[model samples]
Target: MTESGRKLILSYYVSIDGKSVGPTNGMRGVMESIDDEAQEDEYVRQLWEAGAFLMGRASYDAMKGFWPVAEHPSAAPMNAIPKVVFSRTLDSVEEWGASSIASGDLAEEIARLKAEPGKDLFAIAGDSFQRALIAAGVVDEYRLWVLPAAAGTGTALFPEQDGPLRLR
Candidate 1:
């Protein structure tokens, strides 16, 4: 956590061209190509330090299908940490143990989570969900894994905005 208190950290992997999406082929291809064990270890450490995992509906759906069955180094932490998925459409999230759904106002929900006593809240959502958070100006820190390749044409990590962001 930062000096201010527990932070909202958004982590993502992006190509050199600023695309969070994988190569022209797809995410599997790019994911399989990554060979950085050090970075992987660091990511696992971050997960272990997180008080909870925050994500959008789509991300929750995607992860629910994989993490529960994945037998990877990070699976333990991924399954262990509490998760909050923001979605008005989701009626229930019982399948994912230690998880809940937040359908209230985005910023307010994040504020409520921040007020809780614990380590930092980490977000693991795609660009659309991140765009909403960015526009709300609720994110405290960004952890971008700048991959070594170019995606050519894919979704941008950050959406277009009217003003520039001042980062420390």
Candidate 2:
């Protein structure tokens, strides 16, 4: 659930073990197996709702390779919507349309974005980025797409911490 007036929603495609991404074969298999018209429709609908897409440097690198030229239902919104990439290293994001890099403090940047008038900020989950957000306790809502296959070893969605992190 969203709190107050705005929200930061983290979205992810996870393995059965809660790993965001794993071995190439497992990732490929999961992607292929989850194909369905209804699901695709729902996904596109969700994508269209986002006022801006948020991600980290790694995700920008990974996505800048594909989403720019992809021909699919979700491509329209993904390309048209503004994107905010949080990174200290990236200097340019001109390749991807409407994309910008957020180099300020994570908490402060998020606060500013949340204060803006727009739909929820939908995040495309990246391992390190997600871990940082989890540790910082900045993510308001989480949306996980759990796939069937599991990777023997991979990044966990929730990083190790001192106490339990509660969610509804």
Candidate 3:
């Protein structure tokens, strides 16, 4: 947790082989194998539990086209939750109802957000975005949804560091 007592929860969907994207490298394609409504319901609960959501431009672009008109149970919380898109080139984030763009230093931006008084910040990001956060050591907790399939050779979540990590 940060000094503000707010936790930054980094949530992601990985393959059974620990790949950020499975053989398909697509969310809908590979995640379609999940025939469990219980898992989805739990995810919805988690989304509602967050005070704000964070993402990168790519994640925002992909979601902007879908979540705004989505029919899934998670859509409500997804659309309703305040969002922060961390990007250096995004001109506007107003397309989504409650969103703002953060185009500052990555670690500085994370620190500013973490210092804010609110519920824990939630992030569901693409591999590159997630890896950046991991590399910066800004994430307080990681929530991995291990898919029941192998990735074959998908992108890894954690970026290569100078040395091994002793994560708990």
Q: After superposition on all CA atoms, how large is the RMSD of candidate 1?
A: 2.1
lDDT of 2 by residue, 33-124 (tens): 67788988988898888888988998889888788798988889999999999999988999999999899999888878888888988887
Per-residue lDDT of candidate 3, residues 1-168 (tens digit):
667668889999888877776335664476976879999999899999898999999989989989989998889999999999999998999899899999999889988888888889998877788888888889889888888777767787764657875567
Model 3: which residue pairs collide? Answer: none
In model 1, pairs of residues that clash are: none
Angstrom error of the Cα, residue 16, model 3: value is 0.6
Candidate 1, 72-138: lDDT as tens digits: 8889988999999999999998877799999999999988888888989999766788878888989
Give each prediction's root-mean-square deviation over alpha carbons: 2.1, 2.2, 2.1
As a whole number from 0 to 100, the lDDT of residue 53 in candidate 1 is 92
lDDT of each: 0.84, 0.81, 0.85
TM-score of each: 0.90, 0.88, 0.90
Error of 2 at 114 (Å): 0.5
Model 2 residue 87 CA deviation in Å: 1.3
In order of lDDT, best first, we have 3, 1, 2
Candidate 3 Cα outliers beyond 4 Å, as residue runs:
22-27, 159-168
